[model samples]
Target: MVSTVFYVFIFLLALLSYIFIKRNNREPHKRLKLPPGSMGWPYIGETLKLYSQDPNSFFAAKQKRYGEIFKTHILGCKCIMLASPEAAKFVLVTQAHLFKPTYPKSKERLIGPSALFFHQGDYHIRLRKLVQGSLSLVAIRNLVSDIQAIAVSASDSWVSGQIISTFHEMKRYSFEVGILAIFGHLEERYREELKKNYSIVDRGYNSFPTNIPGTPYKKALLARKRLSKILSEIISERKEKRLLEKDLLGCLLNSKDEKGQVLTDEQLADNIIGVLFAAQDTTASVMTWIVKYLHDHPKLLEAVKAEQKEIGKFNDLNNLPLSWTQTRKMPVSYKVVLESLRMASIISFTFREAVDDVEYKGYLIPKGWKVMPLFRNIHHNPEFFTDPQKFDPSRFEVPPKPNTFMPFGSGVHACPGNELAKLEILTMVHHLVTKFRWEVVGSESGIQYGPFPVPQEGLPARFWRESSS
Candidate 1:
């Protein structure tokens, strides 16, 4: 027994030595002279610090301690955090070819490779063109009535004085709009399934990688399977019908590349799911923030109401013919939407991997190292926006220097749905302001950030008919 115990201790020591040697041998960035940051310890690196309760604060602190560019390790990989507009433009716009979207192994497992968000080079360009053209001004203008009608219907369900979660409501609203815009008057049951599939995909993002029973990843996989099944059925149905509706799905179905080849059913389904996932979360979060901001600042609400009143009655929304010229004329409403997005940036950090060795500001960026463009830092920079913490939309009236404000990101991979997102936000805000007057319920109400930051406590607001009624 003594000999066995001694041998066990020896084995333990040997393992520790091996691990120490391996860690010591890990490539060092001595040649790069990159900016300073806390690397923490092995495996976890700065992940714990980087993902602390207040990631924004943590990032800000790091920037304060170590200028604009900083280096850190996360999940055992080297990463560089770019905060300043100069670095942002250099990395995102000027040197875009060297940087590629980077996702964790777990995320890839959930979202799949066929999704447009993950595609690169020519494929991504083609997919983006097809999707963007389908959601063009003409296409979205046609769906405006549908969107307005849905908004009215959704508002009808809200009860005065009853506590309701605006975040969830916005999710449902965006989901419905996306469905109508993408699928166009599909069966009610089919639409419900689309909502379910999105929820599954979202939940999957928060799950651990384990695919065992009861795991979130496992459930997400099941959800993906269900979503794929429905998509397959829809594709098969479309094929059989051969009637083109000219909606997004229809466009994809009818579109062919230069080689006369069309996107396969699976490819189409993945793209659809990708768009839904992207559109739903960001839009819902933005809407929720808009509501929260309006509730928090009653003066802003009044301004919005005045703008709506200038346009006419709430009921006239569907009937009132609106053109791109008219839409851009709502400057206050536009600024409010822009400010909300800037304040409650739904996506804080966009990750990219170095596709090849590159140099920026005399620092070596080795191939495969992860790069993070910390937009939150840029947005809140005092140098760019005076009193950045204050919720003021007017600041945007005189736009900040380019690349300083990228709520939807910058460069080629910038969100294609930016225009549609803006239109939807303005429409929703216009309707809400004209329809009802709401005030924040309690002092406890506040915004929260995580994956997609929104109202911490749902921004429960007590609603009453406006005095103008």
Candidate 2:
């Protein structure tokens, strides 16, 4: 009887211990608060509400109500929106390892999963260094004359009195510059083929991804395949020629793992396409905004024109192209570019996903949740810049507080080609201001999001070439 009683006691003790341990582990999450905000309706979340309004306004409203870090659901995913620079720094710089870069499977399929931005750790580090070296100041400096020529040709093609879409024209110019940086000098046929297919991919990039036979996304998928084949041909030709030059392709071809393994063709194509994709729209958007901003502010236009015209006159007298050094010295134009990037904030936010449950500032960021750093909100925050709505370039005269002005982004994943992008912008502005004058055709001042903010109708404008003095 005493033995039976002892056995019952041990059984009860084990059961109680199991329950206690389980409760401690499971109930902590229940006790922990998620950042405060509405998840909206089940499954759908606030996606419609977000898409229905200006994305900036949607984010601003949330930040105002819930403070810098808030929780919300959009596009069927739980998301944490970080608006403060500290929070952004934590996620992007310090604690980046806890969050991995994330993108939709469909988009990943389109860009090819091998793109460096989709990776982390060693692969990302290796690929980023190569890209940075190719786009470094030293390398791009040598391409100044070539870039100037492309810029001049682009602006020259805009016939006087012809109403052209400035954004469209800028896309062409940026694409050419991207190609120049990638291939040094591609043959005309190859360039044309790449451009033609790339336009299809660009058009479909933001389209609702679907596998329907006639859908834009489907068409993009087809074009992507063709691009792969074309790239293979290019790679074969390069290999046959044994080209050992130092362009991006050359760098990739020559790069090896610790084991001395080179990147596969798919990896090569993906990164090449990735660089082109990154280079095109964002730069074009900013350039378009610069044109509009210059037009809207006549004094600013004259100021930029004067700065550029002086350089032009000097170059013309010397019978020289716009040198890399000349491109760097335009303080006035440079400020205007900075101001434009701030105003547009082309890359409004970036997406990262939590790899595990994480606590930030006493709040739980549950595993698998999306974390987006709202760059536009941080940029436009009145705390950082006085009169955030104003288009004054002088605001940039004093540098913005640290971590508050991330035009290209911050940390490990920041844009490798930012210098090239800036160079292209400065070179284009020089050509635009010195060689031609333009008028915005429509006075309608409104913003359009072609997955990036552009002026409505791509900033319709009429261009007129100035007679040589």
Error of 2 at 89 (Å): 0.6
How many residue pairs clash in all the candidates, one count each?
0, 0
Give every collision pair in model 2: none
Model 1 CA RMSD to the hidden true structure, in angstroms: 8.9
Specify the poorest-scoring 10-residue window by lDDT in model 1: 314-323
> What C-alpha lDDT do the candidate models reach, one value each?
0.80, 0.93
Off by over 4 Å in 1: 1-31, 314-325, 443-446, 465-468
Top candidate when judged by TM-score against the true structure: 2
lDDT of 1 by residue, 132-169 (tens): 88888877876766777788887776755686777778
Q: How do the residues 121-227 of candidate 2 rate in per-residue lDDT, one tens digit apiece? A: 99999999999999999888899999988987887769855789999999999999999999999999999999999999988888999999989999999999999
